[model samples]
Target: MTEIETIESFERHLRSGASLRGVVLQGLDLRGYTRELASVVLAGSVFLGCQLEQESVQAALAQGAMVFPPFLGLPYLPYRSGLYSTEELYAGFDPSRPESYADTLDARIYAHWSAQGRAHPVSIVEALAQRLHDHAITDAMEELLAGGGKHRKVVAIMGGHSMLRGQPDYRGVAVLARELTRHGFFMASGGGPGAMEATHVGAWFARRGEAELDAALAILARAPSYKDREWLSRAFEVRAAFPLSAEDRPACASLGIPTFHYGHEPPNAFATHVAKYFANSVREEGLITIAKAGIVYSPGSAGTIQEIFQDACQNHYNTVGVVSPMIFLGREFWTRTRPIYPLLEQLAQGQEYARFLRITDSLEEIVQALEEYDRFHTLSTIPR
Candidate 1:
């Protein structure tokens, strides 16, 4: 059941004289490996969306191997090996020319999605390809959360995508995320603008000083809203000004789970790993489900409220095995403006997760609550 996702891995396995039996070779170009294919025992092996020569395909089929041909005329790889990176998605982007975004891979795929009828594609082929791509993304995402050997202590920040960059709430969320990330927790967000962008921005500068973060925030504040023409350019400028060093990339790593369902809102550039999805529901559920350490609710709108209850449902039933803390970062926003915290408190009156609920205005309190939960959970899981 070994998976060979990269050409290098496939070559290394072949060189080691390992049998290809029951192996899964995904998204590879096996045209040059026709000789290897003929030499190896291909029984029970599966090749997914691989570019194979006619002879190689025939040989694989004859040897009882399954070969899924690559999906043609698509802007994306349905069997992508890993999660999307900022560089890969924004390859054609130019900070100076905002229109250049229309040419980027992310934009191109979004355009394709729109042309294919958004949520309802006319052709089954298109729908199937999109589903396959999302499945591959989920697979790659799980690998990322696994972090090679160690599991990430993931904490998601849910908020409104409309939260302006220069707002106090936005700044608060960013600072909270930076501190939490520095404390060994992996930060995750919806991966669009507003509070989501702030979450990643904080994590992006986790290895830097507060002054540098303040400087970046000042630059970003020039384009307060994502609708502004210079919003993306300002972000690029900030990235160019204070780039993460090679040593910092691993430490500053964070996850962004964005969706093409709301493709108008481009995924933020700060998240080291982008798990972009076509289905917003799948993406939404997955984002909440992965944040096992806890979730912080920043000031947000309807989408944020939806996520709050979705998370509540998970905790209410203990659906994901262990219930994690649900910390609300804005006391006034959650208790009065939106007034969700009080209702949630009432719903969890006698529940086990009730003790885990926290609504605080202080960032320090939020950090302490998450850290304490991590400590308690670790000790509780230890063998007696």
Candidate 2:
């Protein structure tokens, strides 16, 4: 089935003279294309939340097409075609006036989500709309990872959102992500502050030098915590200082899977692609699932521990087909402070994924392990 998400795609498909059968058109305004709609084979076509004339809607229904009318009074497009970018989410934000964040699309959506009852909306319409939006986000994300005719080597870094800027752990995570991204790995994170922000921050500067990254880190240190008034402002300043060039975007591209479940924590500005969801469970599990190359666990608290076990379950059962490496970045943190690595090791005593488990304090080891795993997987998938 073909998906026509934009006017350009619809027009291109029409020019190609392809039948509209089994086509899925999403979030489009088809009032101008009534004639095209009338001429095409509409059987088996599905239209979601589209703006079609009454006559066109009736025509489509009569012609065996399924047309879902748009929901009224929604803050977001339930049928969005693509993932959100930093610019789109933070459109109304101003660096000088932090209060202006309330006017941003990201903040508005979080506000709306809160008003709708967070995880459990009382209205079925609201719940359904949120689900549809998340589904679209997942679709867009898959499309992004599938771009350029090859799957990205996605690597996720899980850690505490409380990890403050300028902290040694935060800087270490950033450097690790920067180096990994430079090696052609696509970085991913929870997309909030702390270590998550560092992950994207590293990827954002993948094309730059160490001195530049150090300078950015220094500027960010002024607002060490997300709770600070200047946190976002400092991030914006860093971005302004080192804007990503068009040529660098492809190489520096990274994913941020965040949710409105934790509305207090704003999404970081560093991730090139933002797959923000309404359900934290979906966002959390999906983040772990998509990091097929591997996941690096940084020092974190409960949320990070939750993700660690969640990842363990996936690798334990080989649930997603192939098990990937699970690297713990801080040996002392994982082995003693949190002491999760030892339990995980015990649980995976005779498992196939046991060999893939690694606990190291060295960033080089993390990068090398991921590279080696990616290389092996790439070769294994190649046709003889």
Candidate 3:
């Protein structure tokens, strides 16, 4: 396949004339732009999840272009090259009446996908298309982050999204995330609830004092879990009550890479931005890959365990140019119930990779580990 070019405007294509080939029209409105649109070359091109008039569709078909209608299970066009906004996902929702969520775009999208008999999709073709869209979104996300001079400084917090709102662990996650953000790290997470929400919450309140974080947590504590009746509403409530000013908030510092494959868990509202994807595997791998600074592992279940090994593999193989720190936040849980930490220690013994590993319950120790990594791998130029 030729390199694919995304075209969202008809006028842009018109400028290129008959040279249009290997183009992917992304939900662009081409109706009545020109009757001669059919005369242009379209071989090896695709009309990705676009809306078209009968004439345009027939013309594109005759000219050997592939037409794929908007994904029936998703509200927004799947081919668009951008991350989702809360406003876009909650389009029909009213802040004044936060209790009713059935009619919101986010809820509708979730419902549509859920009705398909899966939480995340498992089909081959669907997975391929979703992966393509995810790769584009990742590219766009990297460009946005790189533009802000925080390319490889991104850090991640790994934990189950099921952590309840008012719990001590959740508070610790939030505080740790806030401190990390204050230290100039671009905090990242799986983008779901629990510890992931806390990560974004910390980054969201990076410029504020501990008192403000306490206040926000107090408000969020009203609805402890995403399963609660007012979980989403309470988050909106806190956001509205303690709104971040434009001057104080650096918008793109934190990121959430959540997958719709786990659509049951909504993406946390606190993430400065989100790169939502349809493939969970891609989302999981990408989340680990971008956290060049290091990853902090909090208490979690199977998914978190999988991340531990995956991140270990990356460090063990010296992937991404250098090994990054891996800090375990819960000593008891990781050492006893899980016991994967000892195994990891055994594997790293007598190897240079051992320096990159740390297991501790102390948040301070976690911070020290990351700082040590930076000190040892000091860079002359800013990392990209």
Candidate 4:
């Protein structure tokens, strides 16, 4: 028995299904960047401490590949993986001060990202970016396999990023998420706190909710605000409350990827599989696009309303299969408070704009509208 060491052999190896997680491409002059690239492709690896200077950086960027230095101009040096050493990770955090964690770590991280103004400095972002990027591609590959192009099975639920783990709205969102998941749907969001967290939580509880949504809410109720005294603790407490039995283990799949770009808002630990990324713009734009199942407008603030119109445009053009279903869950909220429902109905009635719309207060009705629209679509597609 032997192992192949050469780059060509490496490509053959990856193509042949030998898996690689991280590959060291450090200190190598990328004169052979192309060959090394072949190795990178083969390993299905994210660039860690890899070098691509001179024309190599420019070349890779021109070819639409990411090319940045490891921790370029970072206040701190040597950026590592989503992979952080307990010390290195905590080098930035002080769990002793949970309250300050929201300030120094959470808000500070987003502030740093915002101030960067999105200038990609490789030295500062190389390792972190590569880890995040590779994770995205790997997950997308899985999703493509599951739903493929234009099926638009993904549905994102955006809301106030401040929604604490335990609140009526949080509980409501979680239950809705569970119902959607039970109907065989995958969910996504800004991947921060609040409604987004609830989405993942509900999906996590998708299997167990048949017997328990109230108990989960009760656990969350102890920490009603994201900025509450013991937000993260209560969340873990809820998870601990639901010890997975062997029989209940393989229930609905909950894959939620929360991001650190908005680290102040903790990623919901409930999402069994997470695809968290560091680039919020990339995540945001991608989140808006991939959702074919149409977004549901809950009683969120401005962010959610913005998502509403963004989704409307996507649906208006049938951007993602006749706009799936723009379901507004709260009648009073959508009809009276902000009042987007009537306006949407008016827009849909426009002869120029063909649309399918449902505005209701019933959670069951919301789910039914989605499934029914989907069924009608399936029937319409077949030759009559």
Candidate 5:
């Protein structure tokens, strides 16, 4: 430890431009420092068990920086890219390798967090690169506004990660996804295996839903679950059935978007843009949250049901502001079998909800309902 004794020593060390590996600030009274200085001083560094004096704490609090644990952006992120394996992600993580350059990009990333005891800033270039990888989304928006493409409406199809590509429900979701995309609404999903990948694959081959889709499903049927090795390639082979080119694509041009946090399953190559994250919880939350535009809870198992109410809670409180359409696709499944929409209605009648929740059987009606909601609703950005 280079003895940084007083404020002067700190100043001298900073001026020297020596790369400070880590900071051991445990119980050093930083309370007298100005809040602005506190933030500026630690903008690009790490703090480990440091005693932030009351004044410093107050400044951090005033500036909206987390004082106790230190503010890191979005605690639930893909901290390490490839550290956790398929089963580990699906279940839990193994012991992290010792701090070294050899593990993986994400392992190193998490190691930084594990050692530092606080959230650290990544290089701005890295941040911008992430932004650019997802430029398809922003471009799509501009394209819609410019009249090249018509819909900016993003409808997420949420369902079980275990649903196979060949089943009836899988085809149902694919047909629903393609139909919705044909109408101009962009389709998004969790970007993982099973139903999420199917949703994207549907969108990828939006225009042509002939025997090709059925063939893809048949191939995937060989491996129903995400754990199967052949599962991902089956979907890709299905995509290979129909050649998608830059000039020649879906007639209406909708996007199939899958993610890779469940990297073991592999992201659907068909998704025009993939806004994947390293954290499953974050990815799951963002997938549901961003679907504030609209959501179609297709026939799914537990995870689907969880997302149903999670979306409802957001809508119930009008969490995103405007009440976007909540269209449950399967009538029999939603009404009688799974019974989510009725539950929502029962919850909303006497209780208060955003008032734009609509459950129906007709695909056209679902799309129209979304349009209607978008028409009258002026979104409020009230802080929660």
Candidate 6:
């Protein structure tokens, strides 16, 4: 009754004349295996995306095997370990034609999913599939982080997706991300537009110098915002201009864990690796939790504020093991305009969270703060 965890194990059992009682066969192609199908016992087993003949399906059903069909035209899977590629999502799209976005794989998938609704309650099939897909993404993310191992520290930039591409703040964040990734820290963000795009774009250009980044930004400035007509097209233009040769790709990767909850804002291409998901709550909390080094908060709206307090709660309760730095990157915005920084500082006065919070206008200060944390503080060891 031992469970079969992989195709190799299933094949080995079949070859050895072993019983498949209580074995779970996930994602295995079971087509044209009449002999194996006839021999094996599939009681209490589950098969996902397994190809089988009609007789085999009936046999498996008779033996109590739960069979799930292969996903149709979905660009992602529940068991994949990496991010979606632009090529996969934009399959038939002509990069030269911005209007082709409407016909892309990503667009089609969004349309289908949106039609089903994204509220707390959804159809059992869609909800179950999405949950399973998200769980797989979490598993894949752990594998990714472990691939970096002890030498790599995860850090992230938090800010509004509304920040335009041509603005000073966007350029500044991009520069900061480029510098950080160059210095062995991995950069991550929400993976949408605005400041998030800037983070990935910076990491994309990490191997290059400031002038190249400026040049790239100038190219992006043509589009400015994601809502602009040429946003995706202009981004591809910059990507082409500063192409990353195979040898030039950074050893430290940048990630974008975007969610379909905000599918209207497309996930940027700059994030070399994207852990896109369906549940936004999981995406948000996990993004903050995984950045063991710390997070840099730029000026944002309600979403940013919510992240601040959510992060503060984690810091206050020491929720994730170590209390990494919480840096506010906009002095005037957070202090004079929002005043959230002062409030946070006031709240943290006698609390353990006080030591981790800092507000500054200088990007140099932000970089230095992270450097100090890496030098002195223990990295967060909390499990995902």
TM-score of 1: 0.99
Better of 3 and 4 by TM-score: 3
TM-score of every candidate relative to the true structure: 0.99, 0.98, 0.82, 0.68, 0.57, 0.85
Q: Where is model 2 more than 4 Å wrong at Cα?
A: none
Q: List the residue pairs that clash in candidate 3.
A: 120-261
lDDT of each: 0.94, 0.93, 0.77, 0.60, 0.56, 0.81
Sorted by lDDT (best first), the order is 1, 2, 6, 3, 4, 5
Best by lDDT: 1
Worst 10 residues of 2 by lDDT: 144-153
Provide the lDDT at 174 for model 2.
Answer: 96
**Per-residue CA lDDT of candidate 5, range 1-384, in tens?**
432324565556656766433432322334455443454544224332234666665554554443323224432222211112222222221223122212433334344434443223366534433333234233333343334444366788887777776677787777777777776667778766667776776776666657876776677687687676555445545555776776645443433333333334455545655444433455566667666568887778887888888887877777766456677777888888887777788887754444667666676777677766655543443344
* Selected candidate, larger lDDT, 1 vs 5: 1
Scored by lDDT, model 5 comes in at 0.56
Off by over 4 Å in 5: 1-151, 248-264, 350-355, 361-364, 374-384
Instruction: Predict model 4's lDDT versus the native.
Output: 0.60
Residue 217, model 3, lDDT: 94
* Per-residue accuracy of model 1 over 1-384 as CA lDDT, tens digit each: 899999999999999998899999999989998888889999899999999999989988999999988999999999999999999999989999999999999999999999999999999999999999999999999998897889999999999888998888889999999999999999999999999999999999998898999999999999999999989999999999999899999999999999999999999989989999998889999999999999999888889899999999999999999899999988888988999999999999999999999999999999999999999999999999
The clash count of every prediction, one per candidate, is 1, 0, 1, 14, 11, 0
At residue 192, give the lDDT of candidate 1: 93
CA-only RMSD, every prediction:
0.8, 0.9, 4.0, 7.4, 12.8, 4.1
Q: What lDDT does model 3 reach?
A: 0.77
Per-residue lDDT over 28-143 for candidate 3, one digit per residue giving the tens place of the 0 to 100 score? 55566446566677776777666677887887788888987766655645576567766566667655576566787667766756655444465655555555677767766776
10 residues in a row with least lDDT, candidate 1: 328-337
Give the Cα-based TM-score of candidate 4 against the true structure. 0.68
